[model samples]
Target: MSAYYDLYETPSPKGREGKKSLHARVCPIKTYTQDEFIKHVAAFQLLPKNQIAGALTAIIDDLCDLLADGYTVEMGDLGFFSTSLKCLQETDDENDKIRAESVTFQNVHLRVSSKFRKRIKHAMKFERVHSLTRKQKKITSTVEERKKRLVSFLKIDICITRKEYIRLTGLTPYEAMKELNDFISQGVLRRRGAGRSVVYVAGENLKVE
Candidate 1:
């Protein structure tokens, strides 16, 4: 088995006029979920699926806790996990004050161990799956169209999901999310709940057609 990639034509950053270049992007053959991964580990280790899953979950929980507490976690062959932060600029003046609120924490960075890197590198192979052009038609609906549709839906339904917006507007998940978030930011819609249960409702000041 080998990793596969699809060739896509992208606008050349430095090219003149209509010039484009083909770029190879990895194309996933299949997605393996956490449950499937746990089952595979259980099979190899001769342990029950539940036990393997629980152990993996505990490791993740502990890893997050340690990272949150400002500790770097070394998993030997796997690598190290550490937290990072972004901070506001401090004035050079001696009397200037910098408080805890000035610092904003960012994502957890991972440094892959040499052992793990070598192991994966030894097994890696790549193949071209298909060629694609950047000439594909855009499927995103206009903002006015989206707003009208959303308001129309609000008249019949209480709320809408990301998936529902995709279906209604024929937009990809990424595009749908951007449009929805734009609506939220513009005060046209308000988000309710979070995660899978999240839905959108019309804002208090929104006018319906």
Candidate 2:
């Protein structure tokens, strides 16, 4: 078995005029090394590998410098970069359409400082937002919150099983099964997967959603 292999037993699809089913399955995420990512970026940018690498490194250094000095850097069409919260002046009218008073972190600005303006002659490297800046934590947090809602929805004492959930939710067989597994792990639902699977029936003693 592969080192990352994980196995899950799914519910059966037999019986109940209209019901859902589950099956044994496993899923794995493809891991990408940093070198692999850089190669892809270099190819996409149509630039020599070394030039792309140097450009990326320099941009990161500049962002770090601005952030360290507690000054937000706003690049006209792009967005601003700064610490969590700091006062900033809005010089560009780029956000005039959306009420000029505020800007969001999602947008990016890429104006280089005047000091470095004359130093870089050729192309001056159009600043890019490297993939490293992505905040996956927010996405992960969202997924968890949705899982919590799923658990609360299933916590009723009305004898709900993985099969019934799939049928009611209209979720694909795989999605229903994955949700069930997540709820089971969260201790909001229980299951016994043997020859025939059954979702543990919660009694009145168990809290209902």
Candidate 3:
């Protein structure tokens, strides 16, 4: 009955670096297709379904044409639609020259009118829905589990390669290396060879208990 939203950490703007702050993003439960959308409009208005569909199709066609023709379309309180341009070949060099053909409309944007925003705010009730948020990517294995898996693999082979260890346990390259070095210091895994040719062998502490 009410709108649902979830908190998401906003990305830092370009050229700026700081701790990110959270923002509310709406969670849409279902997506309406063209037919479903038209049916909904027919339910709300006195117009026939066919007439509403035809009018909607014509409005979309003309909106696209007018926007392409370089005119901003104003849809009453809904907002203003305008286009923005981008150069095909971008460069930082001050001497570099760009041609007309190189520049093209990159995107179409809409600025929602305050009247429309105010109306929505007045009519809608928002609820925080935590389940709508996507879980962040991360390594899920515990420190002991990772160490145990590596120790087990080294027991089966003469030496475990860095690449094989990474595949066996989904640790990133940096994490794998850091853990491998830590194991070496703890006498849990012995470092063999060097650089790209490096491999790991069982150490004194690696004895299974």
Candidate 4:
């Protein structure tokens, strides 16, 4: 099946005055989950679902273990996985010395095999979808208005999630994060917990009504 795309108008850069140009952007159809993938592969290979699932799990465990052991894993024609590191800057002082704390793990870099890259390059096809009309951007409430609303909500709920902030203010995830970060910087809100369990609470400076 051909990949589908939609067109969007690009905003003119500063100091440039001309007609806006259209850009083609991919329109995702749907997502295929891991379980569905295992089932599909089992059907084609004539193997039991449990066997295929176990093998896939083992492969992932081994790959992670190998990467953690400072080894580059080559998965046939798929790709290679290897870890990288980031180190702290050196001090200028003659007595200053580098320690284990100065180094940190960065990320796992992937290098795709030429065969897999060639296969995708030859098979991929694109289809243009109907162009979408640009809608006027919604005007969000002023900072003061948002702060008042947030304070009011905190008075009753005590805490809010990234998702809750989006629902409350009709803001995208990135915009919601920016507003939350601003609140934290202004001493109006403080974050609790970390990662997915994180939530926002009223800061010491906040005077909730």
Q: TM-scores for all candidates?
A: 0.54, 0.27, 0.54, 0.52
| Least well predicted 10-residue stretch by lDDT in candidate 4 | 128-137
Q: Write the number of the candidate with greater TM-score, choosing between 1 and 3.
A: 1
Error of 4 at 37 (Å): 1.5
Order by TM-score, highest first: 1, 3, 4, 2
Q: Across residues 1-209, which tens digit of lDDT does each residue of candidate 3 receive?
A: 34657788898889999888998887665567798778667765656999988998999999999999999999889999999989888799878888889989889999999999999989787655543235534778987998888767766775887668778878654456557767876988886664357788888988854
lDDT of each: 0.76, 0.51, 0.77, 0.79
Enumerate residue pairs that collide in model 2: 11-22, 75-109, 75-110, 75-111, 78-108, 78-109, 79-108, 79-109
lDDT by residue for model 1 (1-209), tens: 34657777787666466756777887653456898678667765789999888888899999999998899999879999999987687577868777789978789999999999999889777755442333444655677887788888888987898879878888655456667767866888887764367899888667754
Off by over 4 Å in 4: 9-23, 88-97, 130-209
Q: Tell me the tens digit of each residue's lDDT in model 2 across 149-178.
A: 444665644456655665555543445556
Worst lDDT 10-window in candidate 1: 128-137
Question: Residue 167 of candidate 2: its Cα lDDT?
Answer: 56
Worst 10 residues of 2 by lDDT: 125-134
For residues 1-209, write the lDDT of model 4, one tens digit per residue: 45557788898899999888988887654445789778667766789999999999999999999998889999899999899987786678868776879978899899999999999889777766442243434746887887787888888999998778878887645456667877876888988765467899999889976
Q: Which stretches of candidate 1 lie over 4 Å from their true place?
A: 15-22, 88-95, 131-209
Cand. 4 Cα-lDDT: 0.79
